[model samples]
Target: MLTVKRLDIADARILIKGASEKANEIGVPMCIAITDESGNLIAFERMDGGKVSSAFVAQDKAFTAAAARKATHEYNAANVPGNLAFGIHTEVGGKLSTVGGGLPVVVDGDVVGGIGLSSGTPQQDMDCAQAGIDYFLQNRG
Candidate 1:
């Protein structure tokens, strides 16, 4: 038999709270999402004044990060013309986002889940998502 770690509600909430706080600090409304190891939605939030389009984009970013076990921006960096992973956005049922702001939630060197943020500049989104990822890594021992 094999045992595995998963993202529970408590951990999910921690991620969301951390992400939200970062977004608020930047004064940028955002859509935030967290997913389990399988890229299944664990929790989500669209901040007031956040763009509606960001809701799905945020979730997709989280899915891409969780499924790939790497930051979504890494995909963008690799998928440029003549790059190794070109046309990857067309794969994965179009769920892979080439933009920034998605990060894997790693615990003990294992990707337990992912968090993504949208509805802000790419840098802002990355910063907020990174905040959540950092908090989880710090608290989830």
Candidate 2:
């Protein structure tokens, strides 16, 4: 048997706020999601004026990051053209995305959750997600 830390709502809010701050700094509206290790959504936010379609994308991104335990772009880079996993986006019932906005949340060297953001360019999404992940890492034991 094993025990692992779970993200509480307060922490989820912290992540959301951190991500929102970054998005505001970049002047990008965002849809953000947080999920637990089992790929279940814990909290989510769609900022005012964010893309209407980005909510689902953000949720799937968080799910993929938590279940896959890697930054989403890492999958994209490793499974590049001519690589073995080039068409991985077609896998996992087409739910896995190798986009820039997804990141696993690690605490004490264990992936406990993930954060995802959408409604911005890939770089903007990554920047916002990274901000939330950094805050989680800094505040967790």
Candidate 1 local lDDT, 1-141, one digit each (tens): 977677998899899888998999989999999999888999999999988999999999999999889898898899899988899987778898878999889888888898989999988999999998777767764
Tens digit of lDDT per residue, candidate 2, span 1-141? 988877888878888988998999989999999999877899999999888788988987888899999888888788789998798876778778888899988877888888989999988999999998877667644
Clash number by candidate, in order = 0, 0
Please identify model 1 stretches exceeding 4 Å from their true place. none
Give each model's whole-structure lDDT: 0.90, 0.87
RMSD of candidate 1 to the true fold?
A: 1.2
RMSD value for candidate 2: 1.4
What's the TM-score of each model vs. the native?
0.95, 0.93
